[model samples]
Structure formats: C-alpha cells, structure tokens
Target: MKPQLANRVHTLTPSTTLAITAKAKDLKEQGIDVIGLGAGEPDYNTPQNILDAALKSMNEGKTKYTPAGGLPALKKAVIDKLQRDQELSYEPSEILVGIGAKHVLYTFFQVFLNELDEVIIPIPYWVSYPEQVKLAGGVPVYIEGTAKQQYKITAQQIKSAITDKTRAIILNSPSNPSGMIYSETELQEIALVCKEANIWIISDEIYEKLIYGDAQHVSIAQVSDDAKERTIIINGVSKSHSMTGWRIGYAAGNKQIIKAMTDLASHSTSNPATTSQYAAIEAYTGTQDAVEEMRAAFESRLEIIFPKVTAIPGFKVLKPQGAFYLLPDVSEAARMTGYVSVDAFVEAILTEANVAVIPGSGFGAPSTIRLSYATSLDLLEAAVARIDSFVRSKWQEDLL
Candidate 1:
C-alpha cells in the first residue's frame, strides 16, 4: 500500500504560473520556438554592486548561518529602509527576514492562523495567498474587486466580509496580475475599517518600488499609529533588486508577532542565505541607479505594448500603474473564437501560436488573461502579434 500523504497536502493547488512557464520551457527544450509570457521574474540581471557584496561575503567567510530572523546589519538596513522610504519606524526586534517574500508570507500564515480562523483575501489575488492560508489551517474568505474599481476592493466590501471568524485581511497594492495600486485615500479608508474591526492587516508590498506614473506606493502602516500597530509590512529585494535567486525577504510589525515568526524560522529554516543577506544589505544601502533603470525599462515596455495589446480584436486592457504584468480581458476574443472558456483560448494560443500566457482563472478573474512584460520589448511585441494572428485565424475558421 502507498503511504498516505497529509490531508493538507491534497488541498494545495499547484501554481499555474509556474506550471505554464514549465510547459513553455519544455517545448523550448524540445527545439520549438516558444515565447513565454508566463514567468514572474524580471529578466534584468542583479546589479554589480550587490553581486560584488555577495562575493565579498564569501571571500570574507561570511557564508554561514545568520540568526534565524536575520543578521543585525541586514535588520538595521531594513529599519533604515522603512524610515527612508515609507516614513514608518520599526526596531530591529520588530523585524524578521526569511528565504523570500513568499516564504515570509508562508511563515506569516503559519504563525498567525488557528484552525477554522478566517482571512479575508481580495479576489483576483496572487495565486499563493489562499493556498498558504489553507495550509496554515485558516479558511480563506474572498471579496471580489470589480474591474470598474481598477481591481481594488472598497472599504465597505472589507467591512461586509468581516465576521466573527475573520482574523485578518490581506492587501496587495501595486498588486500582482492586475498591477493596480491603491491610492492614499483608498488606503486611509480601508485602514479605518480594519482599525475599527480590530483585525490584522497583512500588507504585501514586494512590488512597492516598481510603480510608474504619478502613483506612489504607500504602506497601510503609514496611514496612522493604530494602523501601524495592526499592520504587518511584507517586502523584499527580489523584485526591486532583481535578486530573485538570492531569496531574501522580510516582515516588520508588532514585536510579538515578529518574535513568533522568528521562532518558527528557527526550527524550519535557520536563516535566509547569509551571502544573500549580505547582498541584500548592499542592495538596500547601495546606489539605487539599477533599480531605477529596471523600472524605466519596464515602464517603457508597458508604454509600447499597452496600445498594441488593446488594439488586438476583442481585447481590452487596463493601464497598469505598477508591476510588470498586463491583465487583458479576453472574454470577447474567447467567445468570437468559439472557445467556451478563457483557459481554452490560452491553451490554443500556446499550442497553435507557440506563445504562452497564463489564464486568469487562477487569479479569480476568469474573463481575463495575464501576460508579463518583464522580458524584452521585442519579444513582448512578437508574442502579442502571435496572439493576434492566432485569434484572427480562429475567427476566419469560424466564418467558414
């Protein structure tokens, strides 16, 4: 007889982004020409200064276990960053660093949730939020954010979702998939609701540095003192510094909660990689020129591709204020092509056109599809053209 796996393991959904990326990779390995728009990482290389720091750490024999939470220097860097960027203050004791922002979130859910306790997650969320909550024995309650609202949930929706079982709410601005940012006014209103309900607020600000236009990244903790006390700020250099492989991310909030997370890390994983932690220190403290350069590249790509994508027949897109993704509603295209679902349309494009884009079903927005413009502009243009051709061919066939 096969050994039984834990029941919790069966409940988790594999990441659709990774699955699609892997499929594209497999086709490419088989010598097929595939343009993969499914990856979430920036195509930019890590900055030279950060790379130098990692090498220096290794040369100086600094590649050992750090404190389970993080090195003191890195924690200080995080504290300084919060003060400088968000105008929010946190002591070293109130901070805990983990393998990555995703790991920090996983650790967060593990530490904060009790069985049957509920966390209110906004719809069209990053794919991991609900799975992590479920893995941590928490029930995930979802609130939908309509397209008309720029995919942001209003304070009243949050208030309405709250029940006796609701323990927390997850907020992601400059959000993944949609790339919509919450305004200061919106955040202040939501903060008021959360404060009144006495609920914990998990603010994932990993993409905080990638915002474009006049939109600014504001931390919920920055709204007020009461908000700060209840809000846990999750951030890292993976996105900002193009250091995804380095796996360094962190959380800053109430000292008790931070301590609890640190203790959990002590047993599960000792610390974030020591060399990577050193790299992160340099990333936070060094010249930010590379960060701006990458941001400029992404903004430029978005500017060039947004119009072309919208011009595709039966497609509509919202101009993203931050992050590097474009979520275009493809329901019209799907219907016109005779596909019953958006996923079928996505699969057809991948198989017929050799262009890979993730279906929005995983993001809780089934009418849309997500394409990451993190790659080169040329490739993004080619992918969109291929998609256009594929859709047009389908329409031509239907006409017959």
Candidate 2:
C-alpha cells in the first residue's frame, strides 16, 4: 500500500499564478501564440551594475556561505535603506534576510504563530498569504475590501475581525492582484487599531518603490512608535530592481522576532545565495536611477492599457496606483457570454483567445480576474485586443 501523505501537504493549494503560467508556456511550446499575463515579476532585466557586482563577488571567491541571517554589510545596508527611504530606524540586530520575501514571510509565520492562531488577511491578497499561514498551522481570517473603497479594508472592519486567537494582520500596500495602495490616513487608523489590540502587523512592502502618479507609499511601522514595535517590515529588491531570480529579501522589526527568524534560518536555508547578497548590496547602496526608470515604464504601460482594457464590453477596472497588476471585474462579461463562472471564462480566454490571466477566485475575489501588465506594451495591447475580440464574438453568438 502507498504511504499516506501529511495532512498539511495534502490540503495545500498550488499557486494559481504559477499553474496558469505553466499552462501558457506549454501552449506556446506546442506552437500556439499564447500571450501570458500571469507572471508577477517585472519584464525588465536586472540593472547592469547589480549584475557586475555579483560577477565581482563570484570572481573574488565570495561564493562561500555567510551568516544565516545575512552578511553584516547587507544587514547594515538594509538598515540604512529603511532609515533613508521610510524614515524608520533599525539596528542590524533587528534585521533578518532570507531566500526571498516569500521565504522570509514563511519563516516569520513559523516562528511567531502557534497552532490555531488566526491571521487577519485582507481579501484580494497575494495568492500565497493564506496558504503560508495555513502551512504555519495558523488559521486565516479574511476581511473583504469592497471595490468602492479601492479594495482596502477599513480599520473598523479589522477591529470587528479581531478575536483572542488573532495573532497578526497582513497588510500589503500597492497590493498584489489589485495594485491598490492604502492612504496615510487609512494606515494611521489601522495602525491605531493594531496598537490598541496589541496585534502584530506584518507589512509587506515589496512594491514600495513602484508608486505612480501622485500616490505615495507609506510604511505602517512609520505611523508611530507603538506600531513600529509591533510591526514587521518585509521588503526586497525583486520588484524594485528586477531581481526576482536573485532570491534576496529582508525583514525588519523587533529584535526578538528577528533573532528567532535568524535562528530558524540557521537551520533551514543557511543564507540567501552569497552572490545574490553581493548583488543586493549593490542594489541597495548603488545608484537608484534604474528603479525609477522601470517604474516609469510600468506607469506608461498602465496609461495605455487601462483604457483599452476597460473599453471591452462588460469589464470594469480601477486605475492601479502601484504594482503591475489590474484586477478587472468580469462577472458581467461571464454572464453576457453565457459562462457560469469566472474560472470558466478565464480558461476559455486561454484556450480560445490564447491570453492567460489568473482567475480571481484564487485570490478570494471570484467575480474578477487579475491581469499582470509586466510584459511589453505591444504584447499587452495585443492581449487586450484578443480579449476584446473574444468577448465580442461570444456576445454576438449569444444574440443568435
């Protein structure tokens, strides 16, 4: 007889974004002209200076393992960055680096959560948040953020969701899936709630440098000292520097938590890649012109694509303030085309229109679909046209 798998492993859902991207690649490899908008990484190449730094590190035999938490220089760099960018101060002892932001988050949940601890997560969150909580033996309590509010939940909603079991709340600004940023006032209110409840706040600021238009990114930890004491900041060079494959991300907060995470990392990943650490050092302390250049590119793409996407019949989208995704409500389109569900509509688009987008059901927003604008402008335009044509054709068929 076959051995039974662990319940935790059995119940885990594979990442929907990766699954769809893989399917799109399969179709492309089979000679189909598939345009995939499922990936979350920037399309831009890693900056040349960052690349040169990694090469230099390797040539100098810096490939040997460093501290499990991170190199002293990298941790110091992270500390300097937090101070400079967010106006927040941190000691090196309060920093912990991991394979990536995702790993840092996972390690955090493992170190902090007890069995049945509840983590309040806003809906339309990154696909991994709830699953990561579950993997840590924690229960996820979801609060829905209405479209009218730009998909940001109110502090009152957070207060209502709190219970004795509530351990932490995950806040993602310039959020994944929706690309909605929380205003300073909204964050101050939420921070007040967290401070009163003494709930830990896990602020994922991976897209901090990608704000567009007049929108500004604020760190929850910067709201007040109490909030800073209770909040852990997670960030990386992945989105800002186009270094997704570099596998370097860091966490900053209470030294006790950082120490625990470092101890955990000591047993697990050992350290982020040595060369990647060197590359990240340059990414942080080197020139930042490339960061703004990429942000402008994304903003330019958004300007061109947002209108085109909304013009499609039965689709509605809010202009994103940051990040590279657009969550468009497609329930009307699904119903108009005689489809029963958004997932079916998404699959049909992949199969018929040859355009890949992640279904919103996976992100707890079933009436919508998430499209990444992290591809070239030409490809985005073509994908939008294909989706427009596909929906129009289905609408016409329904008329018959």
Candidate 3:
C-alpha cells in the first residue's frame, strides 16, 4: 500500500499548546529572548508535600500497576475532595482515573461516542475539546460566545446547538483562554436544559481551585439531584497542585458511564503512573495552603493586568471573574493594524514585541487571544506593557 494514515489520525490536528510550545522552544534554542505566554502550564512547582509523598511511595515500591480504574486510596481521596470542596458525593466505583483530566475527557468520548454523534462545545473553549471529539468519530459543534457575553454562553445558545444525535456537552468553568467563570445561576439554567435533553455534561473543573472572587464553581452535579446523575465531573491536580507533569486525573459520574470509561482505559493506559497516583493522593488529602497562596497571587495579577491591557486604544477587556487568563477582544486591533487574524497578530507580537500569547483561533475564537498571568507579577506587568505598546504603535485606525 502507498503511504497512508488512519482516518482518525488523518483528521487529528496536532495539539495547539504543543505546537506553540515547540515553536517557542525552537526560537529559544536559537537564542531569541522569547517571553512565552503560549504554555497552559502553571509556573508554581508541584507542592513539596505532594512530591514528598510520591518519593515515599517509590521508596515503598509503589511503582507497579494498580487497578485499571485506579488505586483505592487515590479514588477515595478524590471522592473526599469532592465532598469537602464542592459538597458533592460519589462512591469509589463511580470514579474513573486516567493519566490526566485531558485523558479522562478524551477517553470519555472514546468510550461514549459513535460515528456521526455530535459534541456541543461552547466556542472559545479549551483547544483540545473539538479535536478529542473528532478523534472519537464525533463532530464538534461550536457555539460562539462573544465579548458582549463576557465570553460566556447562555442556556439558549446551548439549546439551539443540540440535536437528537448530540451525545454530550463540554463545560469548562474558569475556562482556559477566557478565564470566565460561570455563575451558579447560569449553570443551573444550562443544567436544566441539558437535563431535559438528557445531554451528558462533561464538566471540566480542573481549574476549580484557581478561581478568584466570591463567585463559586457550581458543578452541574451540585446543581440538583437530577443534574448530578447527568454529569461527569473532570478534575485533576495539575492546576490545583501545580503537578502538570505528574500526569494524574480522574472523573466521577453515574457508575454505568464510569464503568465504560474504566473499560476503555483498562486497555489503553491501564493505569496512571503509580507514583503519580500516590502524589495525587497527597494533593487531594494535603493542605489547602499552596492552592490558596497561588489564587491570591493570581488575583493580585488580575488587578494589575486589567487596567493596563484595557488602556490600549483597541483592546477590550472584561474583568474576568476567575481563572488566571484574560482574553481581550483584539479584533479591533487586527483591523487597525494590517494583521487579518489573531494568529498573525500573535506572530507579529512575538517577532517584534518579543512577547507570546496564544491566538484566539486556537481556542475557537478569532476575535480574542489568551494572555496568561500565571507567572510572576513583574513578568505579567512587563508582558502587558509590551503588548500595549506594540498594539498602540501599530494603530492605523482601520487602514489595513
């Protein structure tokens, strides 16, 4: 046979974060003083408490395969966290562990979706949602949420996107690119729509602990009893414990769905790294101090970033109620400059301004780009200054 790729492989687009990270790496290797805002990683080191626990596990020879679903202790820890943090209840059998929340989400589709089934994703979502759906032979139907909506979608938009074949909906609070946190009222309304339609809510709460302000993250499961049964809660230690590379994540839901996911994961990853599982156990069971400290720092940066970025003539920023990211409507900047897309603007800024932010196109929104403030306050202040200067200098008043 001539050169060929599987249909699934052919349809897969390389991960946007990986692509951006690779480009940044290459530039850095070549000695470019690149400031990378493209990565989705947390800057904080994995908590020492968690790290110490993993090292102890290794010393105790906990490096072998555990259960396909996960180790009992870790699963129980996750369950405990849900109960303690969000006031949600789940049994061990209802929880399924995988390599990370992304894996949990990907395997969710792989286990549940069939050819031509649809996944409803709010646009400007995490970059992986559409692709993961596609890999599972599902179509991703994106519904755009504009800056006017604070980059948050309404129940009506979700309802309009549904079809009889729509198998699931992905909801991310403290969303990656926009950093927009859904209010309890908004989630309750969306939960009602999805519950009536029997749509699966794959709630991504990986950033649950990263949220700022008095706004709370109401897991659809926490909305009410009916909503709880219809939800698969996606969570991990990556953001909460700054353990991104430790590669442990899990989800909880109705046991039938959890069983299917475990079956799929059994043959695929088998189990997450045993050491990572031990580390994650500590993450859930350990102190809340590290997480609180990080949130405070992010809140501090948000205050600094909002005023400075918005001061730029074409930039429109909605003070994000949560998450460490800010997605300013830079569509106006594109018009005033010669750049036709956020991708082009990102490239220009990196080349001329030496600052890197992910293009909105990657997050399924072309009018906005994601600027992460997950770094030091000084760097965030400096990056925004450079971005402000670059956009202002290129302002030609729609000349392009």
Candidate 4:
C-alpha cells in the first residue's frame, strides 16, 4: 500500500521512536518482561494542578474548537512565555499553537519550503528531519557532527554546508538521542554564521526545562537581533511540565511565517484542543516549582546511569548535558556478541535480556545505541547491569 502511496510518502519511513515502541509492546504482549528504555516521555505524572485545570475547562464546556491561531489567552500565554523565559519578544499575532513540536515543524516545512529549497540539518538530528523535508519538497543538507565534539556541529560546519538554495537550518537542543545542549558560546558561533548567510533557524527547544546539571538551555533567538528576526522558536510543555498526552506545542516567530502556519492549521485540525489549551495556560502560568523538581530528578538519573554504561566493555558514552537520554557507543559490544553490529546487539538485548533500546542507526548514527533513563532509577540500574553482563560474559571480560 505504501509503495502505491504518494511518491513523497513512499520515500519516508515510519517514525523511529514509535516503531521501536510498537516492537516493545508486541514483545510485552507475548509475556516478555521488557524494561522499555526506548520511550521519550517523562516518568512523572502531570502535576495535579495542571490536570485539574484541564478538568475544570471541560466542566466549563470548553471542549469546542478554538481559533486556528489559538484561543486568545493561549496565544497570549505563548507570547508571554517567550518574553519571560527566552528573553525574546513577539506580538500575539506572531504566535501559533499546534498539536506538538512535531506539528509546528511539519506545517512550517510544508508552508514555506518549495521544490529543492535546501534545509540544513545537523546530523545525529532528531529522526524526523529528512523525512519532513522530503514531504515538504525540500532538500535536507545533512552536516555530520562526530562523537568527539559531543555530537554538536560547529559554526565552520554550518558555513561549509550552506548554498543559495539553503532555506532554513533545524536546531534541537537538550537534543534527543544525545542530550547534548549547546552552550551560549556554542550557539553564538552558529548564530554568527547564520546571520552572515541570512539563514533561517528553526530552534527546537522542546526540552527547554529538562536540562540536567550545569547545562544552560539557550534559545538561538536570544543570541542577537538578527537571530530573533529569522528564527522560529518551537517550545512546548511536553517535557518541562510533563504534558505529552495533552498534545500542546507552539512556535513564536516572524509575523509572516506565523500567519502562513496559522492559515494552514486553520484547515487541518482547526486548533489544538480547547481543554489542552486551558491546561497549557496553567502549564506556562503556574509555579516554577514543577519545572525545577522534574529537572532535579532527571539530573539524578543522569548522575547514576552514564558511569555504569561507560564502564561496560566496548561502551563509549559522551556525557549528556541535557535531556534524559544517553547515547552509548556499542559498536564493540555488538562485535563481541558475534552479530556483525549494533542492530543485532539491540535485538538480542531486547529479546534475551528483556531490555528495550533504540538502535543508533535509527538516529542517523550507527554503532551507538540510545538509552532513556526517564524511567525509575531501579529499572535504569538493573537495565545497565544486565547489558554489562551480557557484553562482558559473551565478549570483553577485562573491560568489565
């Protein structure tokens, strides 16, 4: 059916995260005891007040469609959040809310990208970049950042990748699959390059408040005047406030792009849910306590998980600065098991050890595997031990 589908659709694959999740579920239903580390959601429940706000909205008959741009209050809240948190200012008209960060991005690519308009994508990117570019009829120029640099590309790398056809560059921080956050200094370098080239930046800061330790999450728009004008800042409460299922996300940007996306969203889903909008209002306007509390827990997990994984034979882990996932280089671990490489190692671990992880190939970086410590510390500790033994007993004894 997919082969007979639209040419653009056929060119893309199913989402890597969801695919691994489905595989894990199939194993679980078959009575396998799998500790799934492949999920991206926070383990915490949505804070009680935020949930109560949604329930109250429903009781008030707020279930109807909202304006495509968003309810006046939610859009205004998005505006306030940008100014308050990112130190970037925008008119309420410049805000557009949608289903999630994913929707905001997909619609932006569809609306503005034309045939062969190149989008500069940093490699080891979130898995959806190339697929979305293809769907939007744009070319994705991927620039690979090696593991040595903590999977972050430099200003020189960006300068090298641009061409006249390049339209925008996607930037995700407190990055998924890597948890690498760009420092203020690092973002300044990239911003200077983009300003020199007059390039647009799609800054994905969905994990804005989930950073661990000393990681400072800086919005590219906040770097300078030029960056703020050309950048579309994507943010949401999915990670920060534990609101993934509520499906609220937004973009604060230049008026023109915001208008185009609002128009596109007007016909597609109309608006994000009314109750979700109300819930998001609480998410943004509520106390700062929940944000800090969640960050503390995630930091603790990172403190515990990274050392153990790196101690395993053939394992290489770059300390993740933000987000909740650590990408452990498992190339040698794979060879030790006699299965050629990582994909095999991942399969064996999932089936035999009942531990589910995402293969690095899914994230555009083979030989490295992604492990999310967003679950209980007990599960994380147990998962790493099982993996270490599986590798050391079967392969490298001395490293363990």
Candidate 5:
C-alpha cells in the first residue's frame, strides 16, 4: 500500500500561477513561442551593488549560519528601513527574518494559530494566505471584496466576520493580484475594528515600495500605538530590490509573537541563508535608485498594456494602483467565447494562443484572470494582443 500523506498536504492547493508558468516553460522547451504573463517576480536582474555585497560577504567568510531569526546587522537594517519609510519603530527582539516573505508568513501562521481557530481572509487574496492558515490548523473564513469597492474589504465587513473563534485578519495593501492599496483613513478604521475585537492584524507589506500615481502604501501598525501593538508588518527586499531569488523576508510585531516565530524557525530551518541576509541588508541600506527604476518600468508597462487588456471584447479590469498584476473579470469574455468557466478560457488561451495567464479561481475570484506585467513591454503588449485577438475571433465565431 502507498504511504499516507499528512492531512495537511491534502488540503493545500498547488499554486495555479506556478502551475501555469511551468506549463508555459514546458512548451518553450518544446521550441513553441509562448508569452507567459504568469510571473510574479520582476524580470530585472538583482542590482549590481547588492550582488557585489553578497560576494563580499561570502569572500569575507560571512558564510556560516546566522541566528535563526537573522543577523543583528540585517535586523538593524530592517529596523532602520521601517523607521525611514513608515515612521514605525521596532527593536531586534520584535523582528523575525525567515527565508522569504512567504516563508516568514508561514512561520507566523504556524506560531500563531491553534486548531480550529479562525482567520478572516479577504476575498481575492494572495493564494498562499488561506493555504498557510490551513496548514497551521486554522480555519479560513472569507469575506468578499467587490469590484465596486476596488477589491478592498470595509471595516464593517471585518467586524461582521469576527466570531468567538476569530484569531486574526490579514490586510494586504498594494495587494497581490488586484494591486489595490488601502488608504490611511481606511487602515485607521480597520485598526479600530481589530483593536476592539482584540485580534491580531497580519499586514502584508511586501509590495509597499511599488506605489504609483496617487496611491500610497500605509501600514496598519502606523494607525496608532495600540494598532502597532496588534499588527505584524510582513515585508522584505524581494519585490523592492528585484532580489526574489535571495529569499529574505521578515516580520515585526509584538516581541512575544516574534519570539515564538523565531523559535519555530530555529527547529525547522536553522537560519535564512547568511549570504541572502547580507544581500538583504544591502538592499535596505544601499542606494534605492535601482528600486525606483524597476517601479518606473512596471508603471510604464501597466499604462501601456492596461488599455489593451480592457479593449478585449468582455474584459473588465480596474487599473492597478501598485504591484505588477492585473486581475480582470473575464467571465463575460469566457461566456461570449462559449467557454463555461474562466479557468477553461485561461487553458484555451494557453493552448491556442500560446499565451499563459493565471486563472483567478485560485484567488477566490473565479470570474477573473490574473495577468502580470512584470515582463518586458514588447512581451506584455504581444501577450495582450494575442488574448484580445483570441477573444474577438471566438466571439465572432459564436455570433455566426
């Protein structure tokens, strides 16, 4: 008989974005022309200075294990970054650095949750949020954020979702998938709700540095001292520095919780790679010119391709305020093209048009599809044009 896997593994859904990206890669291996719009990482190489920093650390023999939480210098760099960017103060004891923002968040859920405890997740969430909660033996309670609200949940919705089992709520501004940022006023209101309920707030701020136009990134912890006590700010250098492969992310919050996460990390993974931590320190402390340059490139691509995405026969997209993705509701396009579901439409696009986009079903927004503009302008433009042409041709065939 086959060995039984843990129940936890069964509940976890494989990341649809990764799956689609792998499929696109397989086709490319076969020498097919494929434009993949499914990437979540920036296409740019790591900045030269950060690369040099990593090499220097290794050459200087800083290649051993750091403290399970992080190196003191790296933690100081993170503290300085928080103070400089958000005016939030933190100490080394209150910070826990893990492999990446994703892994840091996983460690957090593992430390924070108890079996059957509830975590209130907003709809259109990052795919890993609910899964991580489940892995930590927490129940996921979802609240929907409509298109009219720009995919952001209101404070009242959060209050209504709270129950006796409620342990925490996740707030992702400059959010993944939708890229909608919560305003300072909105965060203050939500902070009030969490404070009243006495539950934790997991503020995912990995994309905080990528804001464009009039949008601003605000940490829930910045609302007030009480809010700061109740909020854990999750952030890292991956998105900001184009250092996704370096795998350095961190959390800052109540010292007790941070300690608990750090303890867990010590057993599961001894430390974040020492070299990556050095790279991250440089990421935070170095000149930020490359960071801004990458942001400008993404904003430029968004401006150029967003209109083309909207021009598709039945696609409805909200212009993203930050981050690199566009979550467009393509249900009408799917229906007009004779597909019963958006997932099927995404598959058809990959198979027929050789364009890979993620189905939003993985994000709890099944009617939509996610397109990442993290690649070059030529590729993004070509991908959108292919999608538009595919939809138009299918719609015309249906009419005939």
Candidate 6:
C-alpha cells in the first residue's frame, strides 16, 4: 500500500511568496538576471554586537539547555523590554521563549485550541495563521478588509463574525502583506469587541520595531487592563535585529497560557537555542542604534519606490505607514495587459519582465500583489523600471 499523509497537511496551501522566491532562485541559477522582491525579511547582516554576544556565550560554555520557557536572565531582559517599551509589567512566569514568533504562535494554538474551535483571522493575514489553526484542529473565520479600509478589519466586523464557537482572534498590526498599522482608536474599538465576546486576542508584533514615518505601534494589549489580561503578545528579534537565522521569539501573556505553551515546548523543541537566547538578551538590553538605522533605510526606500510603483500603468498603491512591503492593487493593470487574473500577470512579470513578485491570492486579496522594499535601492529601482516597461508594452499591445 502507498504511504498516506495526514488530512490536515493534505489540504494546506503552500506559501506563494516562498514558491515565487524559489522560481526566482531557479532563474538566477540559469544566469537570468531576475530581481526578486518577495522576501519577507531584512537584507542587512546581523548587527556586530549581537553576533559577538552569541560567540561570547559559546566561549563561556553556555551551550547547555536552559528551561523550556527560557533562560531566567533572558526572561528578565524580556520583562524589562516590555516595561520600558510598552509600560507593561510582567513576571518571568508570564513569558515563554520559543524558536521564533512563528513557532511560538504554533505552540500556542496547539495548547489552546480544541477540535472544531473557531479562530477569527482578518483577511490578507500572514500565510501561516490559518494553516497553523487548521493543524490545531480549529476553523479559520475571515473578515474582509478592503483596500479602501487600508486593509484593516473593523471592530463591528469582528462583532458580527462572533459565534459561541469562537476561541480567539489573530491580530497582526503593521500587517505582513498590506503593511498597515491600526490606529490607537481602532485598537480600542477592537478590544471592546473582544472583551464583549470573551475571546482571546493573539497579537502578533514581530514587526513592531520596523515601523516607518509618523506611524506609531500600539499593542491592543495596551488598550486596557482587561485587554492585557486576555492578550498574548508574540514578538521576536528576527526583524528588529536582522537575526532571522538565530531563531529567538517570545510570548508574554497570562501565566497559565504561558505555562501551557512552555510545557508543550518542553516535549517538542525542548527550548530555544541557549546561544540564541543569550543573543536575544543582548538584543533587549543593548543599544537599539542598529534597529533605528535599518528602519531609516526602509523608510527611505519606501519614499523613493512608492511613487515609481504607483506610476506603473494601472497600478494603485496605498502608502504604507509601517513594515517593509508594498501591496499594490494590480487588477486593472492585469486587465490592461490582457491577462485574465493577477496571478497570471505576476507570472508574466517574472518570466518576461525578469522581476519576481508575490501574487496576492495566497494572502486572500486576489487583485493585488506584494513587493518587498527590503532590497538595495538600486535593485528596487531597476526592478520597478522593468515592471513599468513590461506593463506598458503589454497594455499597448492590447490596445492595438
């Protein structure tokens, strides 16, 4: 008999961004000058101090396993970070350090959800949220946030979607594909709905440090004591410190939830790497100069590239207030270029224009495409130019 795979994974849709990136990589190996803007990470090297700290920990023989939740010293650093940045106080018992924010969130769902539970996930969500919930035997309920709404779901929308089966809502401000941050007023409204519904709030703040311009990041947990009591904050040093490979992310929340997540981790990953945990402690306790420098670079790129992107024939973009991605509605452009779907338009842009971009269908916004500004300004400019030329040429051909 043939080996059978689990039904949960069989229905899972693979990440479109990674698939596009892999196709771009294949083109690059063939010596095609394909410029990829699908990366969901910073292009900068890890800060020198963080690298040095990791090495220092190894030299000191701190390689042994620590507590499944985290090193006590690292937890202290995380606690201090929360107090300093968010003005929130937390004991070590309320913190759980895991491999990354992604893993931490996965562990959270595994421990918190039961079969047939419902999780309210805002549409155009990060690719993993729905998949993780399904793996935990939970159903994903989506609320659409149109481009006119800056891709943000409303509190009334949340209230309307609630059912007795609702277990939690996954909120990612400074959202992944859209790059939009919710205002403090908006967060308060959402908090009220969650409180009334008595559902948990899973606040993913991994991109907190990468905010740009006059935009501010206010965690929903900061809305009120009741909000904080029910919210679990998922954050990490990956985006903030260019430490993606180091794999250190932590969750701060109710002690009981933290304990359950930590217990699950003990049986699974055991704990995050000790060296990475030491590096994370340094990330929280050390200077944030590099974080600011990277934010500045991304902001500068956004200012330059946004105008160019909007100039592409039939492309419409909402100026992103935070994060490093630009989600542009290209439905009109696709039609003008004689393509039936944005996904097809995206493919033509890669193969013909030699520029890789993520189709928005994977993010539940089929008319749009996501481009990362997390590359060199030179490459960004060149890639935009290619797309502009390609779109115009196809548009002209269609008119003929």
What lDDT does candidate 1 reach at residue 389? 87
lDDT of 2 by residue, 1-400 (tens): 9999889886588776677778888999999999998878999999999999999999999999999999999999999999899989999899998999999999999999999999999988888899999989999999999899899999999999999999999999989989999998999999999888989999999999999999999998988889899999999999999999999999999999999999999999888999999999999999999999999999999999999999999998999999999999999999899899998999899999999999998999999999999999999999999999999989845533
Backbone N/Cα/C clashes per model:
0, 0, 0, 0, 0, 0
Which residue pairs clash in candidate 3?
Answer: none
TM-scores vs. true structure, each candidate? 0.98, 0.98, 0.96, 0.96, 0.98, 0.98
lDDT of 6 by residue, 249-316 (tens): 99999999999999999999988999999999889999889999999999999999999999998899
Predicted candidate 2: what Cα RMSD to the true structure?
1.3
**Residues 259-329 of candidate 4: C-alpha lDDT, one tens digit per residue:** 99999999998899899899999988888788889889989888888889889988988998888899988
> Which pairs clash in model 1?
none
> What are the per-residue Cα lDDT tens digits for candidate 1 across 49-113?
99999999999999788899999999999999999998988999999999999999999999999
Lowest summed lDDT window (length 10), candidate 3: 13-22
Which ten residues in a row are the worst by lDDT in model 2?
Answer: 391-400
lDDT of each: 0.93, 0.94, 0.86, 0.87, 0.93, 0.93
Number of backbone clashes in candidate 2? 0
- Model 3, 96-158: lDDT tens digits are 989999999998888899999998989788988988999989999988888788788899999
Judge candidate 1 at residue 39 and give its lDDT. Answer: 70
Which regions of candidate 6 are displaced past 4 Å?
A: 396-400
The list of candidate 5 runs beyond 4 A from truth reads 396-400
